[model samples]
Target chain A: MSESEYAIEVENLNIYYGNNHVIKSINLKIPQKTVFAIMGPSGCGKSTMLRSFNRLLDLNKNVRVNGSVHLFGRDIYTGDMDSVEVRREVGMVFQYPNPFPHLSIYNNIALGLKMNKLVKSDKELDERIEWALKKAGLWEEVKHRLNDYPSGLSGGQRQRLVIARVIAMKPKVIMMDEPTANIDPVGSKKIEDLIFELKKDYTIVLVTHNPAQAARVSDYVAFIYLGELVEAGETGKIFTAPESKLTEKYLTGKLV
Target chain B: MYQFDMRRIKEYSFLGVISLLSFFMIFPLFHIIFTVFVDGIGTLVSTGPVFITGTLDDGGIGPAILGTLILSFFASLIGIPIAFAVGVYAYEYPYSVIGKATTALLEITQEFPTILVGLFVTQILVLPMGTYSAIAGAFALAIILMPYVAVYTKEAMSQIPFSFREAAFSLGVTKVKTVFLIIAPIAKRGILTGLLISVAKVAGETAPLLFTAGGLYQTYPDSLTQPVGAIPLLIYTLVQSPSPADHAMAWGASLVLLLIFLAAFIPLRLSIKEVRM
Candidate 1:
């Protein structure tokens, strides 16, 4: 894709939680239709920087941000821009699979569409839910029991349901923050496979501590250290021919 | 090894003694329920017609029953909503000075004695409405119930997971709807339980009503401005009287009051058990 097709751009980003500087000055770019993985040790600001893309950090009462993040060539943090509209275009999936305990599988997927008023009729809603579920690879497994509560689903199934919920909104960028942390190895692999399948249609940004997991899925990788961007490039080059000593140590599991 | 066996035996005996103390602690409730049945049965039989009919001169508790029902019902009707809003705001959106002040006031009010509540309401709502008015009685009961409902609702709302809130927020739902639709629905059962307990507590309180609502009488108020007689007030009057028949009506009235409270509580308790913990 050309430079004009860039999906997201971050310049001179700094994030603070009260007095603590959690994310330092950093810059990066993610193009359309690609999966970008952010890897780092615990508390290195990978998650903070990921959340800053859509201003999810604004949820924290202590958080303050100074810098600019752009989505599709538009500044996201500007006064005239609505945070709700930004989130609508850039959807997020949390660490744990949260499918809204009180709602059914079908209702959970339909919730986002309903919020946007994207569907006007019952038949349209039904088809939208089916399409999203199929995209997330959960449609066949849960098709027969659409009305059942989401809490009854297995861990893998719940994660897919969450993905389905987000993808149904037709967000241009889908961000996952350690989405497989709570599930088993088998379930993690399934989600990894699903993420690869998802990048064909939407830009994906994921934060992970596991270099191997990042290698298996991401088209590009960015290594963050103490809130600073250590290195970022094509996934193969970053892993096989890393220029920074810190990146080499982190990739070899010698320093995390 | 010998010392270990002796220690084990000592612990067993200590457990047995503590278990016996628990029975002693609970015995008073049994004594009260048992005594009411034995003491009130004869009164119920002889005055059975008057008891249900509530027609005997200077006797019967119809006015008191009517007063207690109306007063406590109105109290809960007013108090439950206030409690829910205060609880949700205090726990969920507690960034304001007003919310902080309300939470602190509620905590202090919960520990205040019922008679003090009577005094406060007498000065605030009761004196304004006039003593013996049904409105004053309702206000008195509401004052007693508010603290309980607020404290319990806050506790229940706090127990809800932050994940639920984050999930709702991430969905692009506004914070207000996220609170009411997602958080409040999950906390409803606990709120209902608190309201029921508050109802029972207000139903049985005699001290608060004494000053705000005047003694038992046959006259029924046509409006909130008029004097009202509640069951507790009637029981107090009959217990003070010289006539044996009047005293018997007191016990019967006490029994009826106990049953009324239990009837309100049983379903609330059972249904609350079904809510997700």
Candidate 2:
């Protein structure tokens, strides 16, 4: 893809929790409408950088940022920028299936749309809810009991509903933070398939501790270690012929 | 076989000890409620005024009951939001120094005596107003209950897996919206149970009200500034009075208090029930 196709541009991005600098200076460009994966060892800054894209780290009051993260070239961390808008444009899913317990699956999906005022009428809202649920591959399972609480669903179903909630927002970018880490192998494969299907329109940034998952779904791969970016290239090139020893070590399971 | 017989005796003795301990723990509670019901049921049914009229004594408890309810309602109304806000701040914004300090203070508040809470409110609120009243009592009770609400709300909010917050945040929901719309709803039952427990705590309190609420039986107070009566105070006075009718009234009030406690406890218990489905 050309430079014009880039959906996110990072320039000298650095993150800190308290006085300790976590994510070292980093720069990268994520192509539009493709799956980009961030892989790193535990406690590495891979998750931190992913969080910075949408400012999830800001939830921790002690966290401080020292670099620029531009969502489609607009500075995401600027005072004039709305964090909510940044999040809506760049949605997120976590490792665990965390469907809102009090909300029904239908309401869970509808909530995002309602909060953003995306749909005006009840019929339109219902349609949007169904559309999102279908996109997440959860419509059939939850259709009969749209009013049932999300707690009634199985773990995989709950995770899908969470995804549906994100999809309902119609974001430009969907960031999945270890989306399959908490599920069984079968459930993880289902999520992998969903991610492949979702990348047609939305730019996806997936963070995974699992290198295999990154190889499976991502078009481009970025490897991070000890709060520093080790390599960024085409996924095939990064996995099979990594120029960086760190990246090679990671792919081979020699380094955690 | 002889050695095994000795071990069996030890095991039986241990079992006996546990059973006796459980009875020791339960006996007083069972005695208190049973005695109240058996002794007070007769007086409760006989006194037309006890059931129909508000008060049981010369002052009557009607105004006191109303005062207690009104005061408690206001206290809960005021404390619930404040405690909830504090809870959210403490757990949700875990990294903030202010949030940390507030949480620590709330933790300390949990150990504070109700009397001290009353004294503090009296110094700050009741004394400034120049008279004891229901509002003062409510303020005291609210202070007493704020820690409970905060502690439970913090626990409830904290119990939510980090994944939930991450998911909501990634979806572009504002922190405030995420909490109110997502976290608060999920933690509703736990929060409800906590608030109910706080209500039970405030309902049973006598020391705080003794000074702030003035322990007066107002036939009817026009406003919160007027003195009010509560079940605890009625029980206190009834227990102390030489008259048998007064003693009977106290037992009836105790039974009523027990019923209210059970009223709140039953739903709490059901919420915890293992649904077969």
Q: Tell me, what's the RMSD of every candidate?
A: 2.8, 3.6
Clashing pairs in 2: A92-B170, B54-B61, B54-B62, B55-B60, B55-B61, B55-B62, B56-B61, B64-B229
lDDT of 1 by residue, B47-86 (tens): 7656744643645667677788888888888877887778
TM-score of chain B of 1: 0.89
* Alpha-carbon runs more than 4 Å astray in model 1: A1-4, B1-7, B10-14, B49-59, B124-131, B215-222, B242-244, B273-277
C-alpha RMSD (angstroms) for model 2? 3.6
TM-score of each: 0.92, 0.87
- Name the candidate that leads on DockQ: 2
Tell me the native contact fraction for each prediction.
0.25, 0.75
Off by over 4 Å in 2: A1-3, B2-22, B45-64, B77-79, B91-97, B116-132, B215-225, B267-277
Per-residue lDDT of candidate 1, residues A1-256 (tens digit): 2334778999899999999999888999998899999999998999888888877777788899998988888888987368778888888898888887766789888877887788999999999899999999999999999999876788988998999999988889999999999988888888999999999999999999889989999999999999899999999999899999999999888994
Q: Candidate 2 overall Cα lDDT vs. reference?
A: 0.82
Estimate the lDDT of model 1. 0.83
